[model samples]
Target: MISSTTMGLLVLLALSIPVGIVLFLLGFGIDAFFSPFPLIRGLGNLVWSTSNNATLIAIPFFVLLGEVLVRSGVAARTYAALDRWVSWLPGGLVHANVATATMFSATSGSSVATAATVATVAMPQAERLGYDPKLFSGAIAAGGTLGIMIPPSINLIVYGFLTQSSIPKLFLAGLLPGLGLALGFMVIVAIICLLRPDLGGERRMFPFVQMMRALLALVPIILLFTVIIGSIYKGWATPTEAASVGVFGALLIGAVFGTMNLSVLHESLLGTIKITSMIMLVVIGASFLNFTLASANLGGALEGLLDSMNLTPFGLILVVVGIYIVLGFFIETLSLMVVTIPIIVPLVVAQGYDPIWFGILMIVLIEMALITPPVGLNLYVVQGARKTGRMGDVMLGVIPFVLVMLGMVALLIAFPQIALYLPETID
Candidate 1:
């Protein structure tokens, strides 16, 4: 059953079928071939159950908030402002790409949104400044992965929903690791540029006064992040409520910055509808697929396979990491999470691992997947923004960042405190 299901998934995905449709097809296949029970009858309840949730409501709110911010021109200003602070580094404007993506990730929630916003703003600068296209574009693609690792993350929300864990706790757990990944990206870029100076564009230092002024542009973003994350930490709002607050805060910031107008609002709303619809469709389809898989005892089979290996906890973790890395190559990140969490989380928990820590670890892998080849959404996003570069340039550029992500995975496995510390402190 597992073998057949995997083959079906790869074939359908390779055929350019929508991920949601592929999931539905897989669910029907399982129901017909593997499940003795009539799992098809529960499709209505599964769809309703998946869609009717306050937690899931946070997804659209956060997405709209990102859309509003993107359309309002703040993102471009923020990118320029960040360039002033970080462009003096060995990698010049490349550092700014990572920095700006990290900043936006705090609020954008969606990795694709974060990547698109940063790529749109930063790509023009890469061309104008004669920066190396591979490293320059690669930085934006890798840095954008922070969106799902930072607070107010749509992926983290989905992880929490599917795992029945606390969304706020997951948010807290992700904070340090996400920031660490951003810092690691810069460090790696600096080291690489230091070795190959030509790859880095001209490093320019700003006057003290101008650098100070750039701080003003960043204030609104920082305050907006503070308001959303602060509310959740203070126990004043659920993740959903914090997301709505973020939307209002984004609009207010836009208005104050004189960037808000009806046109921007209309674009934000339309973009929100398109993105949210896509997410919900994939989510609902995954829910049905998970239901059918459960009915077919697929989870049990996987557990038995793992248990039969007689692996130690550390060995089990390595196996899980390997699984995600391989699957990450082909699966859309969210769909991967929804389909595997039910089966994987329980197995990891049985091995005495914390689900929250595993979630963070999983996110790091997902982040790597975002920059990985062929199907990596962020690579395509960055490449599309370039409008001229060979796709291979973006793919080759992300190689170093992918290695850094692997290092992050090892760190998390060896010392889970990297993920648990922040969450443990808050409560």
Candidate 2:
């Protein structure tokens, strides 16, 4: 049954069918060939249960927040502000891309939306400046993955909802690791540019007063982040409710900046609906597939396999991480999380490892998944923005970031405190 499912997934993906449709096809195949029961009969229930979720509602809300920022000119201004601060680095505008993404990741929840926003603003600058597209666009895609790592992250909320862990703890756990990766990204850029001076553009330092003035532009985002994350930690709102707070905060910021207009609002709404619908389709399909796979005793197979190995806890973790990296290349991020968390998290926790730490570890791999080829949403998004570059450029661009992500994963493995220390201290 497992073999059949694997073959079906590979074939469907190779045919270039839409991911959502491929998931549905796999569910049907599983029900037909793998299970004794009528798993297909559960499809409607799975779809309804998945879509009716308040937790899943965070998806649209977070995506809406990003749409508002992009439409209101906040994203561009944020990019410009970061440029004033970080363009003095060897990577020039690429540093701004990472810095701007780190800032926005504090507020936005979706990597695709973050990449779209940054790419829209930063892509034009890359072309005008004649920087290497591979490194430039790659930085945007990698930086955008921070959307899932930083606070107010929809992915963390989803993980919490799925695993029944505390959302605030997961948010806290991700903070250091996220920022560490961001700094690591910049360092990599600097080192690469230092080695080959032509890859990056000229580094321009802003005057002290101008840098101070540009700092004001960041106030709105900082306020929005505080409101959203603050509401969650303060117990003023649940994780899902915090998403609403973020949406409202983004709207208020847009109005304050005077970028709010009927036309902008209309575009925001339309773009929100399109992206929400696209994500929901895949999510709903994945939910149905998960249901079928569970009925087919796939979970039992995984449990048995793990038991048969008789490995140490650390060895078990390495195996789990290996599984995620392999599966990450083929699966969409949300679907990958949904399918594996139920099966893997329990085994890891049973080994006496921290769930919060493992969640952060999983996120690092998920971030890598965002930029990997043939299936990475971030790669597609950055490519979609290019309008001229081959898909290969975006793929090539993310290679360095992928290595950075692997280093992060290793760091988390060696020092779980990177993910746990803050959560441990937090009340």
Candidate 3:
């Protein structure tokens, strides 16, 4: 049954069917052929219960927060400001791309939004400055993935919801590793540019006073991140409520920056609706599929199969990581998470791994998925923002950063405390 299900998923996806539809079809197939009891009768209730969560409200709110920053031109200013601060590095403005994405990721929960926001603002600079499109665009694509691993992350929220884990703890768990990954990206860029000076564009250092002044442009985003994350950590608000606060803060900041108007708000709303609808559809479909899979006892079969392997707990985790890497190349990040969380999380937990730590580790892998080939959403997003460039450039550019991500995965496995320290310290 597992082998057949895997084959069906690949076949449907290869046929170019939408991921949401594929999940629904898989659920119906399992109900008809695999389950002893009827699963179709409960579909409506399952979807309602899945979508009715208040925590999920954070999705649209965070999307709007990113949209507001992008439409109001604040994102551009922030990118330029970071350019003043980090362009002196070996990779020049590419460092700014990664820095801007890291800053934006603190507030923007969606990796796609983070990537789009950075690409929209930074692509023009790359063309004008004569930077290699491959490395510059690759930095944006790879850096934007920090969105999921950073706090106020939509992916972490979804993982928490599906696993019944504490969302705030998950957020805390992701913080250290996320920031570490961003720093790792910057270091890799520096090393590469140092080795091949031509790949890096001109390195320009702003005056010290000017660099200090550029810090002002970053204030709004930092404050917004602090408010959203602080509220949750301080026990003053839930994640959903904090997301509402983030939207209001973003709007107020937009107004203070003299960029807020009805047009911006209107566009932000439309973007939010489009993104939120897409996410909810995938979530709803996955919920039904998970219900059907559980009814079919797919979890039992998977667990029994693993138990028969007689592997160490660490070996089991390595296998899980391998599964995600392989599945990630074909599946969209959200679809991948929603589909596998039910089956995989329980098995890992049974081996005595912490879910919060595992959640952070999963996100690191998902970050790689965002930049990987064919199905990597971030790669396409960065490529689309380019006025002239082959998609292959973006693909080739991400190779080094993907290796950085793999090292991050190994670090997380070898030293679980990287993800756990913040949460444990706070508790």
Candidate 4:
């Protein structure tokens, strides 16, 4: 059955079908070929349950927040500000890409939105400056993955909602690791540029007064992050409610910045609808497929496989990590999490591993998945932003970051506290 599903996915995806459609086709195949039950009957229920979710409502809200920021000129200002601060680094504006993405990650919940925001504002600069498209675009795609790792992340909220973990704790657990990955990305860029000077743009230093002025440009994003995350930790609102707070905060900031107008708002709303609808289609399809897969004894097969291994706790973790990396290559990040977490998380917890730690671990793997080939959403996003470059450049650019992610995985394995320390101390 597993073999059959794998072949089906390959054949359908090779035909260049849309990922959401491919998932539906695979679900139907699973129901008809592998399962004994009439799993297709559950499709309507799964679609309704997935879309009607209050928690999932955060998806649209976060995407809208990013849209407002980008359409309002805030994202461009923030990118320019970061460029002033980090352009002196060895990698020049590429460092700014990582920095801006990190900042936006604090405010926005969606990685695609973060990538789109950064790419929209930064891509023009890459062309103007004669920077390598691979690293420039790769930085945006890889850095945008921070959206899921930072506090107030929609992906973490979704993981919590699905796994029955505390959202606040998940948020806390992500803080340190998120920052660490940003730093790691910078370090890798520096090393790469240091080895081959031609890969990066010339490092430029800004005056002290100009740098201070740039600092002021960050105020709007800082305030928005505080409002959204503070509301959650202060018990003033649930994660969903905080998303509403974020939307209002974005609008107010845009208006105050004098970038808000009827046309801007309309475009923002339309962009939000298009992205939200795209994501929801995949999400809804994934949920229905999950229902059918679960009913078809896929979970039982996974359990039997794990049980047969009879490995130690650490060994079991490595297996899980391996599983996510392999699956990550083929599945969308959210769908990958939805389809596997039900079967995998329970097994990891049974091995005496911390759920929060595992969640962060899974996120790092998922972040890698975002950049990996064949089905990586980030790859497609970065490619879409480019007018002429081949997709392979973006894929090649992410290779170093993928290595960084591997090291991060090993670090988390060596010291579980990397993920658990902040959450444990906070509450």
The RMSD of every model to the true structure, in order and in angstroms, is: 0.8, 1.9, 0.9, 2.1
**What is the lDDT for 393 in model 4?**
92
Candidate 4 local lDDT, 113-207, one digit each (tens): 88888888888888888788888888999999999999878779778877889888898888889999999999999999999877888888999
Supply candidate 1's per-residue lDDT for 424. 91
Model 2 C-alpha lDDT per residue in residues 371-411, reported as the tens digit of each score: 98768999888888888878888888888889999999999
**Cα lDDT tens digits for candidate 3, 261-374:** 999999999999999999999999999989999999999999999999998999999999999999999989999999999999999998899999999999999999999987
Model 4 per-residue lDDT at 207: 99
Error of 4 at 68 (Å): 0.8
Pairs clashing in candidate 3?
A: none
Worst 10 residues of 2 by lDDT: 1-10
Candidate 2 clashing pairs?
A: none
**Model 2 accuracy (lDDT, Cα):** 0.87
Regions of candidate 1 where Cα sits further than 4 Å from its true position: none
Q: On lDDT, who's better, 2 or 3?
A: 3
Evaluated at residue 335, the lDDT of candidate 3 is 91
Candidate 3: C-alpha RMSD to true structure equals: 0.9
Q: What is the lDDT of residue 305 in candidate 4?
A: 81
Give the distance in Å from residue 36's predicted Cα in candidate 1 to where it truly belongs: 1.2
Model 3 segments more than 4 A misplaced? none
Q: Model 1, range 1-427, lDDT digits (tens) per residue?
A: 7888888998999999999999999999999999899888989988998999889999999999999999999899999889889989999999999999999999899899999999999888888899999999999999999999999899999999999998999999999999999999999999999999999989999998999999999999999999999999999998899999999999998999898999999999999999999999999999999999998999999988988999999999999999989998998888888888988999999989999999999999988888886689999999889999699999999999999999999999889999999889877
Better of 1 and 4 by TM-score: 1
